[model samples]
Target chain A: MRPLRRLVLAIPALWLFAFFLAPFALVAKISVSRPLVAQPPYEPVFSLADGWQGLWDKLSRLTLDAYALVFSDDLYLDAYLSSLRLAAIATLLTLLIGFPLAHAMTRAPRQWRTALVLLAIAPFWTSFLIRIYAWIMILKDEGLLNHALLSLGLIHAPLSIFATEAAVLIGIVYSYLPFMVLPLYTALEKQDPALLEAAADLGATPLRAFWRITCPLAWPGIFAGLLLVFIPAVGEFVIPDLLGGSDTLMIGRSLWNEFFENRDWPAASAVAIVLLAILIVPLVLHERQQVKERAA
Target chain B: MKRGLQPFHLAVLALGFGFLYVPIALLVLYSFNASRLVTVWGGFSTHWYEALLGNEALLASAFVSLRVALVSSVLATILGTMAAFALVRFGRFSGRTLFAGALYAPLVMPEVIIGLSLLLLFVGLGIDRGFWTIVAGHTTLGLCFVTVVVQARLATFDRSLEEAAMDLGATPLATFRAVTLPLIAPAMLAGCLLAFTLSLDDFVIASFTSGPGSTTLPMRIYAQVRLGVTPEVNAISTLLIGFVGFILLGAAAINRLRKPQGSG
Candidate 1:
């Protein structure tokens, strides 16, 4: 039994350690290095030039230039801020739209619950890029939405929605709506029906019962949904790049440009490390909360 | 309790479904457009599908993406099942906290960070970026999700059945292979499907790790979208959607047939 357990644990442990932990440490190490014109395009902060003392000298070779550059430049700052802002707004919007849909699912006939739940997840079965691309076709100036508006005589000019922050918001909300909805539905679905019935028997209005009973009970779902959407949205690249104009600067794009376009691997690592830094507190809190939940 | 959906709930659900489906519907409708322009529908035609058949680069990328998705998803599922088994069945082991943290961290870690970190690791190790790198990135990304899913199934499994088997003087390995494997096979299949879909849909990690002449389908589609949408894109997208929809529905049908009535 012991040998079997060891074998079961060893393969995955080694794999994740090598591919996951080591890479993350590499990010931290490389973020402190200077940009160079080489194959990997970054100077190694460590070297073995003259044995022990050479290693000490190699440590000194690492610089704070990348972190300093991020702080000094407004581009990186704005990218961080806008990513948070867009992600926050998108989270709120998805919650608003997703709440009703999830509520509707819980209220759906029990016989249809599986189908309804499947409906919520169906979009995900398609290629994510195509789903985002579909929005581009619908929101572009000469796209379907504008065409409908024009035919209805509601607008004389095409709406400039395709390459704007609003477009990015639309794409984010669209892509993540299921993430927001599924958890909320699960939370809502699991509520004891008798509790809501008891609330009703006490003469609470339906809306009041929802707020007083459903919302309070579903708080965990809301938090989970928010985390699901916000964390990924903040670092989302494909949606903003496809839907957003130059005005929409986000950390994901910043990291990509520094690595690929600007060829500054260290700078890109800095952006990612900082992005992770900003998110770590919330992430840690969430994890701690999960641990507590599991304990209870 | 109400016996049926309220009018208000129906309206909201209708609107939500419309929002979800309309864009996809439009894409399907335009796939057959005779006109090259996205908005202008000249007439119905299959020209774009024919063009898609002729696009060798796109075909090659799709093939690579398929092969990558297949290999990585299988590897991820195996690794993920092991992780799930260790976490659930084994008592606390050395480095449990670190192992658990490593498992959960990737769940919310941004693709940019994961991609960058892994790419740098590959470069640091002098491993050239290409097909193997994309598989490595995707396997890392999908491992957590598969574990989460398979762990859910493991949590609900009837453990005493395995216990009974073991009590009959069967070795743990024999018990697992003979009893547990068949029972959890459905969940494993589901987990594999999820890992496959995740690998297929990935763009950021794939883009970061992919090298010259190794473009995946998403990479190809993203490059083409930047140039502007053609009917060809819509045709290919519709086909992809159809293929995925078939898989999802088929999976659902299987689950429906197999599921016990009173439980989730």
Candidate 2:
């Protein structure tokens, strides 16, 4: 069994070594290689002295410029703060909305459980681009919401919604709500009814019982959902770009501009390396939990 | 007696579902609207869908997306399945954690960053940013998902059969080909399909890697959306939703078949 295991494991190791690790190593190497402009498109000009010294200079230079630019530029700083705030808000909203729906599905009259689950996952299965695009139709200046409101005499002017932070918020919340819900539902379904009943019998109010017993028991799932939504939300590109106005200069978009528009490899890699450092802890913890779950 | 759902729970559920479906439902409805302006509903017609079908650029982009998705998804799935087999079957190894982290890095790394870094790598290699560059990008991301799905199936599998086959003098390859492959084939297929969908739907990475002539469907749609959406986008979106809806239904059917009759 052990020897067979060794052989099986070798396959993935070789594959990863060739594709995954090599590509990232290449990214790091290219970040420092002098950008050659005259080759129709930019290419790396690698020289022996240039290789080591260039990496050091590029690394040091990229850190200062990118870091300074990200911090000193009020627009970039504001986009970062707003993005953080929105991702936090969206994750909370998803939990608030998802917990009840997940709870309802698990405890609902038997006939409705599958239907509710299907409904929850249905939107998720659709192309993410379409789902986000769907919001533009509903949230734009003369879009569905404004038209409906105007006809109903709610307001005279169309709401300025299309290119706003609020639209991005709505998009993020919608995109990730299912991610939050699925884990919560899985956790809630496995919960024992007796624990809740016991709390109630001990003279706890229903709310008290839920807060004290259900919440802690469901903490792992809640954390899983948080990691699922929050981490991706931090790095989200499509939602903010599509929904946010010119004011939104998220790190993702910032990185995009650096690579495509500015054609700066070192700067882009610096931003990515920083983002990776920020994301590593949560990702590591989540993977550990997943691995443990499977082992058990 | 236990209480049924409280009014608060009921309201939240209703509001959540309403939020999820209303925007999407409206898009599908408005796609058929005759008005070119998104805000006004001239009348119900399929002119936008007709326009979508008539547009050569849209069709070409869709073709490009399909081709990239098909090639990359197959490659990713094959590599992922092989890796999953190794991970589950192999008891322990030096630097396994490092290897696992590398494999899963693309999953947590923001797509924007991945796209940027990969683009830089390609440019540095003097490689032209085009269809194949996009394929490399998609495959990197797609493999993580494929590995996760296949790993899940492998964990649940009984390993004694493979051991038995090996003990009977059948080589490792023969045992795997005859026994293990048959058992995990469903999961492998599901993972591949999931990879295909993800690659097809990918926008961020594809946008960074692809040059002008190689735009994918999502890339084209994104460009249109950024320029302020028209109903033609709505029409394209409706078609995407329909296509994915069919795929999900098929997935659900397969999932149901995999379970035994007595199990919920």
Expressed as tens digits, the lDDT of each residue in B1-264 for candidate 1 is 574599999999999988998889999999999999888889999999999998999999999999999999999999999998887778677887677778877877778888888888888888989999999999987787788778778878899999999899999779989889878778888888888888888888999899888899989999998988888889999988887778877987887776774244
How do the residues A102-204 of candidate 1 rate in per-residue lDDT, one tens digit apiece?
A: 9998888889999998888888767789999999999999998899999999999999999899999999999999989998998888898888899999999
- Chain A TM-score for each candidate, in the given order? 0.95, 0.85
TM-score on alpha carbons, each prediction: 0.96, 0.89
Worst ten-residue run, lDDT, model 1 chain A? Answer: A287-296
How displaced is residue A5 in candidate 1, in Å? 0.5
> Each prediction's Cα RMSD?
2.3, 3.5
Against the true two-chain complex, what DockQ does each candidate achieve? 0.70, 0.55
Best by DockQ: 1
TM-score of chain B of 1: 0.92
Candidate 2 falls in which docking quality class? medium
